[model samples]
Target: MSQGNYRVAIDIGTTKVCTIIVRKRADHRVEVCGISIVPCDGMSKGMVAESASVTVAIKESVEAAAADAGVEVNAVYTGLTGSHIESKNRWANVPRSEGMRPVTDLDLSAAKKAAGAIDLPDDRRLLHVIPRSYALDGLHGVRNPLGMHTGELHIESHVITGSISKITKLHNAVFDAGVRVSSMVVEPLASADAVLTADEREEGAVLVDVGGGTSDIAVYHDGSVVHTAVIPVGGFQFSNDLSIAFAIDFESAERLKIKHGTAAPELAGMKEEITLHPTTMSQPLTISKREIGQVLKERTSELFRMIQLKLEEPHLADIPTDRIVFTGGGAKLDGFLNIAKYIFQRKVRLASPRGLDGMPEGTNDPAYSAAVGIALWGMRNLPAENHVDERKISHTSENSGTATLANKQTAGALSMIRGWLPKRDKETAGT
Candidate 1:
C-alpha cells in the first residue's frame, strides 16, 4: 500500500498485454499484489501495428491492475522484443592516472561508459549496456577488479540495441496510455532473470522464451549474458498453420491447438480423432489428433532449425552452452520438449517463473514468465538507481555546505519524485 514499496510491470506482447503490480517484501522477494491479462490485436511480431489500439489496451490493462492492487499506477517497467532487437559484445579500457593504485568504483564506471560509447547507426537506439566481465593489466576474465591494484582497467560489456522507429512507437504507445515508462526491459533478459537458476547461468545455459509472436533467445555463461537474439516465429505461427491445414477458422484452430496440439505426433495418439463444431461450419467435422500434431511438428522442426541457425551464426557458434531452457506460451504445447530434444540433441528443459512469492493460482505457467520477470527486474535494479541518486545528492549537499534555498527546494522535489518513481540506472540508459 505504500508508494515506495510497489513496482509495476507491463509486458506488451503480440497477442496479449499483461500488467502486474508487486510489492517488495522485507526478505527481498516480490509479492504479486495485482495482475491483469488482456487480449490484444494491436501488435504484430512485437511491433505496434495500431498505436491507438495498443494505447487503449495498455490503459485498460494498467487500470485493471491498479484497481485490483488498490494503488495508483504512474510508471512501469515494460518489456520489449522483436526481430529488430540486436546485441553484441564491446570492450573498453580505462587508464588510471594514479600510478598502480587500487581500482576504484569510478574506474569501473568509466570502463562501462567507455564500452557503451560505441557508434550506433541513426536508426538504432541503445537499450542496455550490461557489464559482462572485468580484466586488469593483461589479465582476462577477472570478475571484479575493484580494490585490486592496477594501473589500467578493462571492461567487457554486452550492448543491446533496437530499431529507433520501433522503440519510439512503443514508448509513445505507453505514454499515450497515461503512464511513464520507468524502464524498457529486454524481454529475453527479463525472462532469464525470472526463470534461470544461478547454477544454470554460472555453468552456461540458453533461455528460449517463445512468446505469441516471437521467440526470444539469450545465451549465458560465466554469470553474464553473452549473446541475445529474437526469432520472428512463435505460437501465432503454429496456430495459423493449423488453421490453414485443417481449413478451420483461426479461433477454432487456436482452441484445437491448445486442446490437442503436440510437437511430436507419434507420441500424442497419432490414430486418435476428435470431432469439432466450428462456428464457420454448420456441420461437425472430424479432425485427427495426429494431423494436428504433424502440422505442428513441421513448424516445430523449422523453429528448431531456425534456432540452430541463429546459434551457428557468426560469433555465436562457439559460446559453449548445450543446456537450453524453454519458457513462454509457445513452449506449452504437448510434447514440445520431445521435439526440441530430438532436434537440438542437447539438454532441454521447460522453466517457469521463480523467485517470487504470492503467485496467483494458474499464473505460474511459462506464459507469464516475462511479465513476472519484468516485475522482478524492476524490484532488483530500480532501487539501485534510487540509492545512487540519493548518494549523489547527499554527497553534493555535504561538500557544498552553503547550499542555496532554491537548491534545497529542488532536492526536496526530487526526493519526493524518487519516492514515487525511481530514476533510471545510467548503465541501462534508454531502458
Candidate 2:
C-alpha cells in the first residue's frame, strides 16, 4: 500500500490499548493492513492514572501494528472517554447583512460559530459542536439551509466538551509513545460510527458502548448526535464485583466472569458447578454457576438502571425512540442483551464494527469497534496526506514554522467535521 494512503487510529482503553492501520483503496473503501492489541494497566474509568505505563503500552501497540503493516506511522487519531465529558444543545442566529440574499457556505459557517460561542470554564476544552437542524427566518427543521432566502439563519447545535487536564495527560502519553495526535474523537461517537446504521441514526437510537472501565452512551436522532455521556462502570467493575464476592484475586475473578458470567441468572443452568484453583486459594474451590450469574446480575442491572436514569433526564425524556444498541467487550457477556431488553423494555441488539474491509477474522467482535471506528474517523476528519506540504514541515523550526503547520492541520480537522454520521457535507462548529 502507498504510504500516502495509510491511516492509523489508536484506542486507549483501561484494560487494553488497540492500534489499527488501514489503507484507502482506489474505490475509497478502507481495508485493514495491520492491527495490534496490547494489555494496558495505566488507566481507570477512561482517565490515565499512570502516564509512564500508558506511554509504554501505547508504544508497544503502535510499533507492533506498524511492524505488522510494514510501514511507519508518525501520527494517529485517538479516542477519548471519561465521566468528565459533557454535552448540551446550543442555538444561535445569524442575520445576513445582505437581507434576503441566498444562504451560502459562509453564512452557514457564521451561524455555526455563533452557536458554538459558549463560555467554557478554564478546565474544560471544547471537543465538537455539531449542527442538528436549521431554521430560516421563522421556519424550522430545514435540513440543508444553503441556497435558501432568509433574513436570519438559525442553528441548533450539539456541543460536546471534556476536561482539559485529562485531555492533556492523554496527549502527553501518546506523544511520549512517539506519535502525534492528529485529533481526539470522543469514544461514544467513534463506536456509534462503527456499529450504527444510517436508518438507526435517522430513525433515532441509543448506542451504549460498554468498554472495560466505562460504558459510553451516544443518542442520535434525525442523523445527528443529540446526547453523549460516559458512565464509570464496565467490565472491570463486573470482574471486581465477582472478585470481592468470592474472595479471589482479580485475575481469577476475571477468568471466572468471562467463562461463566451472564446478566440473566435465570438463563444459567441451576445445578451446574464450576471449580477453580485460584492462586489466592490453597485448595480447590467449587461454586455454582448460578451464583456467579447472580453476582453479575446485580452489577449489570445497576448499570442498566443507571443508563435508564440518564435517559430520564428532563431533556432526554421526550426523545422519540425506544431502540438501544450495545457494543464493546462487556456487551458480549452471555445474556447481556436479554437482561438489557428486560430492563429497558425496548428493542436491543449487540453490534460489531462495520464499514471496513479485510478486517482480521478475530477482530470482528465488539471489543474492536472503537479502534476500527477511530480509523474511519481519521479518514473523514484528517486532511489528505497529499494536501499537506511535507517540505514546510521539514524545513520549519520546532517552535515557529512548525506551529504554523500545526495550526493549519487543526483548521483542516475542524473543517472536515461536516457531520458525525457517515457522509454529510455541512461544516462543523467548535473551537
Candidate 3:
C-alpha cells in the first residue's frame, strides 16, 4: 500500500467494472494490494450506452479500490473489446533518402504509419498497430532494425480498428469520473499478456477469453501476434438461453448457469435437480442438472463452432493452434475443457493470472483474468501518473451530474503506449 510503489488498472466489462491496485515489492516484483468490483450500468458488449450512468459506476469501482489500497487513484489504464473490433495484417516498405542509410526510430514510425493508410469509413479509427516483425536491407523478420544500415525498411504489422463512437464514449465515461486514461489495451492482448506463457506464445498459441458479452480470439506464433478477433457471442448468451428455456428471470438464469451448468450434459447425473422459485402465477419448477447441462451444452457448443469458423479464416493461414488457453467468466463452466478440446481439437488449458500476490484466497477466477492482466500490462508499460487524494477533488463533480465530453485528436496515442519499464532484479536490488 506504499504510495510510490503502486500502479492501478481497470477493466470495464459487461457484467461488472473491476479495478486492481498492484504494489511493486522490495524485490521489484508486483503483488496485488487492492481489488474492487462494482456492478456495471449503461454498458453492453463493451460499448458505453450512457456515459452518465457509466461514469458513476467507474467512480464507484475506482473509489472502492482506492479505499482498499489506502491511496487515491488519479489515472488508470483500461482495455476495450466488442464485436465492432476488427483486425488485419499489413505490410509497409519505405525507401530511405540518399543520406538516410541506417534505419531510425523516425523511419520505423513512418513505416508503421504507412501500414494504416488502408481505406476505412470515417466512423472507424485504428485501435492498435502491432509490429509482427521488421526487415532491414533484405533481411526478414528482424526484431529490431535500429541503427542498421539499409536503403529501405519494411514492417509487418497487425492493425486493429473499432468504431470511433464506441471509443469516445468510453473515454468520456472515464474522464467524467475524474481520471485520465494513461493508455488503452485491446482486451485479448491484455489477457494474453497475463495468461499466455512465453513458451506458448513462442511455439504458437491461441487465447480465447469468453467474457459476459464478447469472446476475444488472439493467435500468436514465432513470438508475435498474427491474428485477433472479437466474436459477438459469449457467456451472457448462455445465461439468456437458460433464462428462456427454464422460464426464469435473467439474473436467476445467470446464477443457474454459474452454479449448475455444464458443457457436457452426457457426463452429468440425470437425477440431480435444481429448484427455481416460480414467479407470481406459477408453481415452483424443478429442473434436473442433466437438463441444465443440456441447455448450456447446446449454446456453448454453438459459440465454439462460431469461434472455429473465425479461426478458419483464410488470412489466418493456419497459425499454430498446438496450444490453446481459456480464460474469463465462461471458462468456469463444468466440462468446459472437454467441449473446447472437441471444438478446438488442440491441447487446451484453463488459465488465470499465475504469479500475483496479496489477492484474497479463491478470488482468482477466470472472470477476473482480464482485470489482472490490465494491471500487469499497465505496470509494465505506462508510467504511474501521480495520485491525487479524494479530499482535493470536488464532491459536486462526483455527484450525478452531466459532463461535457472531450476527445484527444490523434489515433497514434494508443499505438505509442507499448514500452516496458526496466526492472532491476528484485533479490539483488536491496542487497
lDDT of 1 by residue, 1-431 (tens): 12356678989988778888776655566666667776677888777888998899899888876655545777888999999999998888775685788888888878878888888899998899899888887789998888999777888899999998999999999999999887999999999999999988998898999987889999998898999999978888888888778777777877888888998899877679989988888999998899899999999999999989878867666666789999998999999999899889899999999977756555678988999999887777655322111221221222122223223323432333223211111121110
True-vs-predicted CA distance for residue 300, candidate 1, Å:
0.3
Would you estimate the TM-scores of all the predictions? 0.87, 0.88, 0.84
Ranking by lDDT: 2, 1, 3
**What local distance difference test score does each model get?**
0.79, 0.81, 0.74
- In model 2, where do residues sit more than 4 Å from their true spots? 1-3, 386-431
Model 3, span 211-328: residue lDDT tens: 8777888998878788999886677778777877877766677778877889898888879998887453278879999999988898888988888888887876657677889999
The total number of steric clashes, by the backbone 3 Å criterion, in model 3 comes to 1
Query: Model 2 — TM-score against the truth?
Result: 0.88
Q: Any residue pairs clashing in model 1, and if so which?
A: 184-431
Per-residue lDDT over 71-172 for candidate 2, one digit per residue giving the tens place of the 0 to 100 score: 577888899998999999878887569578789999888987888788999999999888889988879888898898888789999899999999999999
Residue 207 shift from truth in candidate 2, angstroms:
0.3
Error of 3 at 367 (Å): 0.9
